[model samples]
Target: MSDERRLDVLRAIVQDYVSTSEPVGSKALLERHHLGVSAATVRNDMAALEDEGLIAAPHTSAGRIPTDAGYRLFVDKLSQIKPLTRAERSAIETFLSQSVDLDDVVTRTVRLLSSLTGQVAVMQYPSLNAATVRHVELVSLAADRLMLVVILSTGQVEQRILELGSPTHLDDEAAVAQLRSRVNELSVGRRRAEAAVALVAAVAELEAPPGDAQGQSRAAVLRAVAGVLAEQREDRVVLAGTANLARSSNDFPLTLSPVLQALEEHVVLLRLLASMDGESRESVAVRIGAENPISDLASTSVVTASYTAGGVAGLGVLGPTRMNYPSTMAAVRAVARYVTEILNQ
Candidate 1:
């Protein structure tokens, strides 16, 4: 009768469908929920919801399922995410607090989300091009080989190795010292890719040959920056809880396969997270089924929250279309907040 009663019915139907993975019928809704109405009245409400495109019934005798619009309404207006319990809060705090390095922090964060939610979890380390360099070190490994370590403001560490076309006349210790000074002189506090491109072009301009004064210095810098950016181009993308998808046998081929394929593409996931930029890190974003631009992901749903280290970088997570939005959103938002705090510390 009233919009309120219809909304209550919609919520009940969605919760029932999500748990049962089946269409919801009016008789079932009336039998299970204390909706204070007859089955006929409930059926009328379902029809209205269907007309509004919030719920759908697949067969003549079947019950209803919430459409994307329905879930969006639920997440945007009706859903109340239960807060993390004290135990969960303490455990997340403990796990994240243990990490003193960026790699450790992200690894633990992915595991934490997977364990807590039992869903496929994706965490994106910030784009290498967006980060400011904290420091760069050149360590000589051999007469003709050297290792370049690049540290970013987010505590991310990347190392690259460069082999000289021919051994330089300088001693290993002296060459390393000179290389570090030269690379950092140009790269520290700059973008690795941007600086690397510039440094490479700079080296390609030297008037002297490879072993000459201007040429040798420029070549060393070139090798170091190139190594670091090349390493970052093949970045890390950690995924867990894939077995959880196996439990869904109802529409396995149609629903799960595409999502799994999309997950394997690091570039796709990165682009998805990157496209959701401009939203504040604390805000929760909803991408409905089929709204995902990736055709493989069209049947899946994704909710993303950008986790940031103040001004340094941001990380994100992607899960299923039928996700427990309230709980998952809360878990993701809380973890992102705590992780940012840890990185800031």
Candidate 2:
């Protein structure tokens, strides 16, 4: 048999089984598809595919179903992810554009992906490690108190309220404005890692006119700016459509309870996304059953794509091994692209 014909049979079996949840036979494959082969010819091809371990006969008289290896091949080698229809694209823009902030975008993305794919959705919060300083704002509330806000290109906001060591020194509005300007100048284009170090030197070089008051004021204001910009960032993820998992509860041989447990653990989901981050944006990362390192998720398949707005993050779907790879991949890719566009905006 030709390799092309054999793969065609495997594709037909996978599609039929995925749709009907029933073992596929030569007769049904011929009936539903234009394979241009006789029933006997298809049956012979099925036997060849089964021998290759790509498709398996579930029972003595049953037709064949794609094994995990089969599904993986079908996803990696045979499938062309269907493109989203015009209506689907419009829905994505409408749903995501309603977001008010970074948190809102990530939150709505999970819901949108889950609804689109009919599976659990996972969206990793954008990594701020590569983020550049976007803006810095300072507000003085009291002689000794001021609020410093640090905004990053990734849309992460950090605030540090400073109780000035010498309140009277930083009390002047002009001093605060000068300090804010210097901080933004030094930190705005620098990466998060470089901002803290650069801001400190910029403060020290400030040419304050001689006097205890002016000197003390410069020192106090600069200290507040540096303090607020220096801090560690933690990576986070948001998930939605977990209830969708319950719909496929019976699909798990051991039970979906463990899968649900895995979702609740953020570390588990983060690591899962990290594993998939290496793939280029043009192709979706698909981790099939047993391919997942987590034993609880061994029965599930994860499809993810890394997104870059300010930095690299991840978004994808989690579904049963029997998922419709083509359509699900399309939904994930479309949503991840829209999310990246939204983040960059």
Task: Go through the candidates in order and give each one's C-alpha lDDT.
Answer: 0.72, 0.84
**Which residues of candidate 1, in runs, are more than 4 Å off?**
27-39, 140-146, 165-182, 197-236, 251-255, 279-282, 309-320
Tens digits of lDDT, candidate 2, 175-289? 7787778778888978776887786776666646666676666666766566655666678888889898788776687788889899999999999888778874557899999
RMSD to the hidden true structure, all candidates = 3.9, 2.0
Cα TM-score per model: 0.80, 0.93
| Candidate 2 C-alpha error for residue 254, in Å | 1.5
Residue 335, candidate 1: how far off, in angstroms?
2.1
Residue 321, candidate 1: Cα error in Å is 3.5
- Output the worst ten-in-a-row residue range by lDDT, candidate 2: 202-211
